[model samples]
Target: ARRVVATLSIGKRSHFATARVAMEAYAKRVGAEFVVVDSTAHASLARWNATLHSGSNSHFMKLPMLQWFLEHYDQLLFLDDDVLVSPFAPDLFSSVPCEAFGAVYEGYHKQGWHSMHARSFCSLYGLA
Candidate 1:
């Protein structure tokens, strides 16, 4: 299966630069292609910046990036530029089923959904 590890890097500088070396090594270990989308010059960025009040520009950019990746890849592992993967981490592609979407739900706790962040995220995608 075609698999890719992708991240979006926007703004004046590349946030992915610091973690690129390590992330590329991890992607190689996991047998996936590594890609970075530098969208600082994208036309949609200015519009998104002006209109979006709920999420940051980078977060909104992920929606289109995800759509593009899904069209070209059988599986994709989308990580924030700031995330560094451990060399010893397992191959996540093998763990998830082909037809299902996988994500780490950090907004939930023992008391149930506890933050506005989670609610806003769900509402953003109409999952609420």
Candidate 2:
């Protein structure tokens, strides 16, 4: 299956520099193409915004990005530009079923921020 690992990097904040090298190497090792989309680029953002409900906000770009990638590639692993992949980490896609959606649980964050947010989100959505 054709596989890609991609991220959106907006503005000039050195969005992917710190993590790109490691992630690129990991993508190579895992036989997946690595891509970094600069959302600030006119054509890139324009294309994403063309999708229904897509907006100019950088955070909202993920939906359109996922839509485009899933249409073109068999599978994609999307990551935030701030994320760093460890050299010792295993191939993340190998263990999952291709048809299933997968995500890493960040509720275990050291500061409990994600956990707290999740709880609040659950309560707000009446899922608690």
Best-fitting candidate, scored by TM-score: 2
Candidate 1 matches the true fold with a TM-score of 0.64
> Which residue runs of candidate 1 sit more than 4 Å off their true CA positions?
13-15, 40-59, 107-128
| lDDT score, candidate 1, position 32 | 95
TM-score of each: 0.64, 0.71
Q: Where is the poorest 10-residue window by lDDT in model 2?
A: 50-59
lDDT by residue (38-83, candidate 1, tens digit) is 6644542444554466555455656765777787799999888766
Regions of model 2 farther than 4 Å from truth? 40-47, 51-59, 108-128
lDDT of 2 at 24: 91
Q: Residue 84 deviation, candidate 2, in Å? A: 1.0
TM-score of 2: 0.71
User: How many residue pairs clash per model?
Assistant: 0, 0
